[model samples]
Target chain A: SQQGEEDPQALSIQEGENATMNCSYKTSINNLQWYRQNSGRGLVHLILIRSNEREKHSGRLRVTLDTSKKSSSLLITASRAADTASYFCATDETYFQGAQKLVFGQGTRLTINP
Target chain B: EAGVTQFPSHSVIEKGQTVTLRCDPISGHDNLYWYRRVMGKEIKFLLHFVKESKQDESGMPNNRFLAERTGGTYSTLKVQPAELEDSGVYFCASSPPGVTDTQYFGPGTRLTVL
Candidate 1:
C-alpha cells in the first residue's frame, strides 16, 4: 500500500524558476527522503530529513518536514532544464529488524520549459 | 565505485509468460531492495534482502511473484505466468549498514507485458 501521497501531480515552470513539491503520509516515520527520476531511468537519492529535524538543505535543494501534519516538502531552487523529471517522497514506515521498506508516494512530474 | 546494476534494460513478453529479472547491488552492501512502478501509480516496494536472507516481502503482490537473493551478492525476481498488470519498471537498490537511510538505485528494467 502507498502510505505517502504527493500533491501537484504535474508542474511546469521555466528554467531558473523554483519548483516545490509536497508529500503527505499516513503514519509516523523515522525519516523522510526525496528522490528524482529522469525519463526511462531509475530514481536518484536526493536529500533526507529525519523526523527530529525540521528542515535540511543540500546545494539548491531544501527539505522541510512537519511530523505533526505528516507532511514533507521539497524545494528545488533555480531549476535547470536537466532538472526536468519526476520527484518522489518516500517514508520509512517500518524500520524494525532491518526491514526498511520505503513507502513511496505518487510522484510529481516536473517539466522545466527552457 | 560501481553503483547497483540490473540486467536486460528492457523486456517485452506476452501475457502468461515467465520473466526473471536480476539485480547486482554495490559491493559489500548488506541491504538490497526491489521496487516496481506500475502504470501511473506510485513506485511500490516488492521486497528487502539482508545478505542472503529474505528480510521482508510484505508488499509482494501474490504467489506468482518470487524473489531470491542467493549468495547475498545479487538478487533475482521471477514472475510466473505474468499478467498485464505486472508490466512496470523494476528497480534495484542497495544501501550499506549505517545510520544513513540513503539507497543507491540502478537503472531499472522496463518490463512490458502484452
Candidate 2:
C-alpha cells in the first residue's frame, strides 16, 4: 500500500492561474517534500516542509503541512507553460538506524495552457 | 557542481535478458537511493545505500535485482533475466550527509522489456 496519495489525477489551467495540489499520507513523517518531473526528465526537488512547520514559501510556490490531518497542499502562483509536469508528494519517515526512505504518491499531472 | 548523472537514458530488451543501469552521484554525497515507476503507477522506493552499505532495501521487489556501490561512490543496478513487469523508469537519487530533506535526482533510465 502506498503511504501518500495526491488528489486530482490531472489538472489543466491557464497560464496566469494558480494551481493547487493536495497530498494525504497515512503515517507520521519527519518531513514532506514535493517534486516535479518534466516529460522524460528527472524529478526536481520543489519544497519541503517539516512536520513541525505549518507553512513555507519559496519564490512563487507555497506549501502547507497539517500534521494533524496528515495532509499537505502545494500552491503554484502564476502558472507557466514550463510548469507543466507531474507533481508528487513524498513522505520521509525514520527507519532503522535513523536511515530514511521516501514513500511517494501517484502524483498530479498539471498542464498550464498559454 | 555537477548534478547526479545516469547512463543509458533509454534501454530496450527482451524478457529473460539482462540490463544494467548506472548512476553517479554528486561529489561527496554519501546517501544514494533507487526508485522505480511503472506505467500509470506511483514511483516507489527500491533501495537505499549509505556509503557502499545497504542501509535499507525493504522495497526491492525480488532477488533478480542486484545493486552495488563500490568504494562508496557511483552505483549500479543489474537485473538478470528481467521480466516484463520490470519495465519502467529507474531513478537514482543522492543526498549529502546529514541532509535528508533534499535529494538530487538523475534523469532516469527508461527500461522496456518485450
Best by lDDT: 2
Model 1, span B1-114: residue lDDT tens: 999999879999999999999999999898999999999799998888888887788879999999999898999999998999999999999989652267889999999999
Second chain TM-score, each model: 0.96, 0.98
Q: Quote fnat for model 2.
A: 0.73
Candidate 1, A3-98: lDDT as tens digits? 888989999999999999999998888899999999998899999899999999999999999999999999999999999999999998565564
| Best candidate according to DockQ | 2
Clashing pairs in 2: none
Compute the lDDT of residue A65 as modeled in candidate 2: 97
In order, what is each prediction's RMSD in angstroms? 1.4, 1.1
lDDT of 2 by residue, A1-114 (tens): 437899988999999999999999998888999999999999999988999999999999999999999999999999999999999999986776777888899999999999
lDDT of 2 by residue, B7-29 (tens): 88999999999999999999999
User: What is candidate 2's local distance difference test score?
Assistant: 0.93
lDDT, residue A108, model 2:
97
TM-score to native of every candidate shown = 0.96, 0.97
At residue A54, give the lDDT of candidate 2.
100
Model number with the top TM-score = 2
